[model samples]
Target: MTGLRERKRARTHAAISEAAIALFLERGFDEVSVAQVAEAAEVSKRTLFAYFPAKEDLVVHRFADHETEAARVVLARPPDAGPLAALRDHFLDGLRRRDPITGLNDVPEILALTRMVVEAPALRTRMIRFQEASERALAEALQDTAGVPALTARLAATQVVGVHWLLSMDNSRALLGGQSADERCPAAVADAGHAFALLSEGLAAHL
Candidate 1:
């Protein structure tokens, strides 16, 4: 169980993030300043910076929750399950839930955040960095779990990360183009199945 101090910290962290995102969505990411976010959150600039080291971080920190998610999925797979199988199943599950991380969510807030990230150069760049960190985490997990060499693990991570990113991008484009998540569900599932099948075939020989 979390202690009172930890719970309070979590609440404060969430409050800051919520305030920052609301401001960014309303006034635009670039237009909103750090001081303004701190004021809105009712925290000092020092406290806000303590929670988020950078302005781009205030927007991108949500992505941080999933930075090591792929790695965790791989590590926690059933004894007989292959890494790719676990990952594919996890992503499919996310789609079923309309997970915002899967880019299949049509929630207005999620759509606004996605558009904001796409339009803001800094956010885009920071998101790319998050992707890079995710790839690294997955690579390490692959190396540890599959006992593959570093180079091979890295190569596999690159492929897996790229495929997932492309699939998510396709989903986002469909929704942003006016297609609902329910309408896009079939294509998204089919695409995931096909992509994972291709990956399984390629990775089988290597692993």
Candidate 2:
């Protein structure tokens, strides 16, 4: 169970993020300053910075939650489960749950956040960095698995993560075009199946 102090801190953190995102969505990402976000959240500039180290972070903080998710998925898979199988299953599950990274979420506020990230230059660059970090972490996970060469793991990570990136963009486009999650889900699932089938061609022999 979380202590009072920790719960209070979580509430404050959520407040700051919510305030920052609302401001950015209303006024645009570049126009909203850090001080303004702090004021709106009823926190100090120091506290805001403590929660989000950079301006781009306010919008992209959610990405931090999944920074090493691929690694964790791969590491925790059953002994007999191939790495590719684990990833494919994980992504498919995300699609079912309408996970944001899977681009299956149709929530208005979530769509707004996606638009904010897509339209902002800093957020785009930071997103690329986060994707790279995820890939690097997955590569390390691959290396830790037996019979997988370091180079092979790196190559595999790149190929796998590339598919995920493309899927996210496709889902975002469909959502922004006004498709709801229920409408987009079948296609999303189909697309994911196709993607993994294609990946398995070159990657099957390796994993």
Candidate 3:
């Protein structure tokens, strides 16, 4: 019964998200209201709020799903592997797969979603908060798993998160500029290698 209820709840949540994204893409994010999203999803305003605390959340929730991903990658790395290596490998894997979060995907819906986030000041601000949370999670992982000092973990997290964000943005720009993912893959791989090598040099003593 509990599993069934959870599954039902997941469906409701997905429905709300899909409906909200569809409407936001159709109309402008600013033009659509929370009430309209509720109506479109067949949920009450209160229920929609229960799932998403703010209007920006209705769009950025997918990003929020990945907020702790870097931390997870660090924690799950092989005992012999370093945190930086795990993250670099994970990102390289994402690029190969054209993961939407890596910003290399050219799917029509993903491109439209990226455009919406870029054009909407509110969404961009929310995304900044998301990045902060991701950094914090990675910092905590470093301190916990590697016994890194608090300050060092935080500084490392800052640099690492900033690097990933910049790389992802570059990939997004290439795709948005009409480059196919396949065309961008080699350059993206080279960029990742260069970025991670730089990070390795800077973080070697600490991480």
> What ranking emerges by TM-score with the best candidate at the front?
3, 1, 2
Q: What TM-score would each prediction reach against the true structure?
A: 0.94, 0.93, 0.96
lDDT per residue as tens, model 2, 1-207: 469889999999899989988899999999999999999999999998988899888877778878888889999999999999999999999999999988889888889989888888899999988989989999999999746898999999988888998998899989999899899999999999999999999899988
Off by over 4 Å in 1: none
Give stretches of model 3 more than 4 Å off. Answer: none
Name the candidate that leads on lDDT.
3
- Model 1, C-alpha of 180: deviation from truth (Å): 0.4
CA lDDT of every candidate? 0.92, 0.90, 0.93
How does model 2 fare in lDDT?
A: 0.90
Clashing pairs in 1: none
Residue 53 error for model 3, in Å?
Answer: 0.7
